[model samples]
Target: MFDQNFIENPYPTYRALREAGSAHWNGDFLGGAWLLPRHADIAPVLRDARLSAQRSHCYSALLPEPVQPAFAEFNRVFGMWLLFQDAPEHTLLRKLMNKGFAPQVTDLWRDAITRTAHTLIDRLPAHGTVDYMGSFAHPFPALVICELMGVDARDQAEFIEWSDAIARFFGNPASSLEVAYRGRDSLLAMTRYFEAVVEQRRHAPGDDLISLLIRIEEDEEALNGEQVASQCSMLMFGGHETTRNLLGNGMLALLRHPDQMQALRDDRSRIPNAVREMLRYDSPVQYLTRIAAEDFEYAGAQIRRGQMVVPLIASGNRDETRHADADRFDIGRADTAHFAFGHGPHVCIGTRLALLEAEIAFDALLARCPHIAAVDTRPEWLANFGFRGLSTLRLDMQTQPADAGAVAA
Candidate 1:
């Protein structure tokens, strides 16, 4: 039996796990593997350098023996993406990717992304609502990454569809093999497509990231095509989909916490803090995984080597010890020391960029439409354990200026 309920909504179980500490539950409903829910217990394990992010750790004895083989390919290929890797390799790959994302470089995309946000919002029907995820959330990030990553604007919808399919491979164990298989195939196709794009850039490089990759691939760094493809895939997912969910998820938070939303409207200066609070309160990513090294002791229990360690980072933000009043949403709150971007050497590289896009996009929307509200619909959560974001959210609002409409009234 799978825990679909927990998958659909995990906060309650997370609370139980926290209160219960690191308890082993092979309950009738919950199947396979032990659970660790406490924020304190999970954090050190995630930050533990001894616990590796490699294949050996992933195939730990703590995991069901049958699962080991299934996760083999994932552990292997995923290493190229840098996010899953631990040290020098991680450092090198992140540095190369960061080369293109230099502070001055990402700043260049601000106007384009901001303009794209208004363009998407403008297309919404007058006095009605649209699926914020499909229209606004999904497209904003898609177009931003497309323009920045050198993908044609026409290909965004495909990226959105494929990324959604693959996102299910994360989080819970019940994710269908069909989802994983299809997602892998989709990634392969994209990689093949990127291969040609990278090749073209090799001969005729532009000022884009693809061009940057082409340049780096040739240098002594000698990053192979497969590695380039790996980074490309990371760029597509991390650059596009996560931002989509952040905007959508962040907006949903505002809807739920109108006080915070009102706080932004009351003062434009509060947008930055509000964005951080939104990320901390309910981040786009919820869980991260690691594998134990040698036998280690945690919370009076001996965690054997090769045991799979899952740290609930979202829960970590709500960690009472780390954050004061962990559950409440306070834009002005001072101790917002959240692990939302992750922690350690592998924290998200695009953190500053994500925060920038969120703040500017949210600011533009609130300024244009004063009386914004979520349409009557249930927001869908994505299918990944490592990400927390809305599948879709529809916002109902009126437009302005006749051309802009009369919505803000």
Candidate 2:
């Protein structure tokens, strides 16, 4: 299943997995893990207390025992991430982090996000084919997250590089040791980069997430400087990586389903629903991993402690039992229940920010580009099963006049 065909479209494989049994053990997947395919099974497993969020051990098992110690920095940074924590630790860190990501705080950046979207859109060619991934999808969120994190917008290239390396290793279960080494280097580089930024913010604070984290650290003494920096690296990665894919994947969906695209263009209010459907239809985040905290029977499969549990979020989104016409992409569907951003405590903390960014992005794109068509109807997908996204999406667009559209990019 780790072939190009599966990478291009894993849904058929997901359907087969879901239909065949409740769970299947794949020895090659992260050195052996139980794959949970259905929504009913995944939903509860995500919330199950027996399924621990601490999967660093599972990650370490990917490398040879002797080489594992070389990834100490990788494990250190991963430990600081709230996604890999469970129970009281996860609860406390999430609460502390929430202060910075509060709705009111996130709302303060609407103007910045809008401006970034338009600035990137403005750079697009007037009447020619362009790779949306490079032109808009990738850089748009990178810049936004940079602004919010108090990092230099010019440093986005390095940021994307570091995140991509780590993602490539983390997302693909079949990653090589060489890929693991690259991911380790990237993670360490990013952590060191943020260490300096965090130090600067300590002396001279700014109205950004880093400064906010520092404030939380000072007030509560819950996190140290290094931990704060680690969170910054995590946030930077979480902030853009998935959102970038969402923009690309969502736009590709619209380009494929002209009727749905027209529906949103006709009524801008449907943009929100359209975003939801886009997430459900082709989720950017495809899978989430967990370590079985204890032995238990789930979906008729006997799960053993220390075993990795892989929940296919993309598969769960398309589960027929929960969603009617599960395979179809309809923006107006009412039953949009999905694990796109995941479910339960470990759900993506960047969900609200991501949704707002997508909403603003689609709104601005539809308003500015009156006529848009896919340059390559069958675009190639990245060989990444976990973070499902197009490698590149070339679009032929008829951009509106600079002075047109009251939407004000």
Candidate 3:
């Protein structure tokens, strides 16, 4: 079941698993983690204090003997990532990060997000097929986050490559030693780059997030250079990688359901809900790993201490108990409650920003290109199990007749 074909569309397998029980001991992946497949099971596990979010302990057991040494750098850097830390550490980091990541601060980027979306759309071919993922989805969020971080625009391409490598390290458990080394190298380079950024900000601060991290304080606690660099790297990864997938997956979902797409196009007010539905129907992050902080019984299974408990967020989103016609991609679905952005204390900090980007992106695409359809019905899916995204989404687009105010710059 851990094969590539299953990864492409694991819903059938998930449904079968869900029918069997809420949780199952799946020895196939993660060296035998307890797989939680239902909304009831997965939702509570997310908030369960007995589960540790620190995944390095779990990953260490999964690493092969030969790859163990090569995985050291990845473990060190990713260990510092906010997603992998638990308790007081996570609390402190989140509190400090929130100063600059507050909703109001993200709202300040709405105009910039809108402008970026339009600029990307403008560059799209007017009446020809184009790879949406390449032309728009991938770069839009990357550029936005880079601009927010005050990173050099000339290095945006390199940043994207580094981000992809790091994502592969986290999402692909079966990655070979060479792959792991590549991911570590990319992370090392990113760490050094951010370290310089942090040092520069320390001496000569600016208005970007890196500068904010350097100066932001919570009582006597403050982030050091390395912590700042790690946070910056985490933010850059989360800021773009998942959002890019959201745009691609959301667009593909709309294309698959034209009626719903037309409904959203006609009433832009529904774009927000549509985005929510898109997340629920096809979550960007498929699963999240949590270690058993202590031995505990959950969903009729005996979970031992230090064991990995993987909540299949994608499975939970599609559980029939959670939503009527859970499998259908209905943009107007009222129940948008989903584990897509995750749950509990570890929920995504950039949730609002990602949603705003998608809202603006879909609004712009639908408004500008009235006639757009997928070139291939079965679009290729990214191979990673944790992150669900399209590798390439080709769309044949036709521009709408120009309005009185619509004039090329």
- lDDT agreement with native, every candidate: 0.69, 0.87, 0.85
What are the RMSDs of all candidates, in order? 4.2, 1.6, 2.1
Q: Which stretches of candidate 3 lie over 4 Å from their true place?
A: 400-409
By summed lDDT, which 10 consecutive residues of candidate 1 come out lowest? 400-409
Answer with 1 or 2, whichever has the higher lDDT. 2
Q: Candidate 2's residue-wise lDDT over 75-122, tens digit each?
A: 878777888889888888888888888899888888888888888888
- Per-residue lDDT tens digits for candidate 3, residues 374-400, read 999789988888888988999899765
Ten residues in sequence with the least summed lDDT for candidate 2: 400-409
Clashing pairs in model 1, backbone N/Cα/C closer than 3 A: 60-306, 171-385, 284-388, 380-391, 398-407, 399-405, 399-406, 399-407, 400-404, 400-405
TM-score of 2: 0.97
After superposing candidate 1 on the true structure, give the runs of residues whose Cα lies further than 4 Å from its correct spot.
1-8, 22-36, 55-76, 217-219, 383-385, 401-409
Residue ranges of candidate 2 with Cα displaced over 4 Å: 217-219, 401-409
Clash totals in order = 10, 0, 0
TM-score, candidate number 1: 0.87
- TM-score ranking, best first: 2, 3, 1
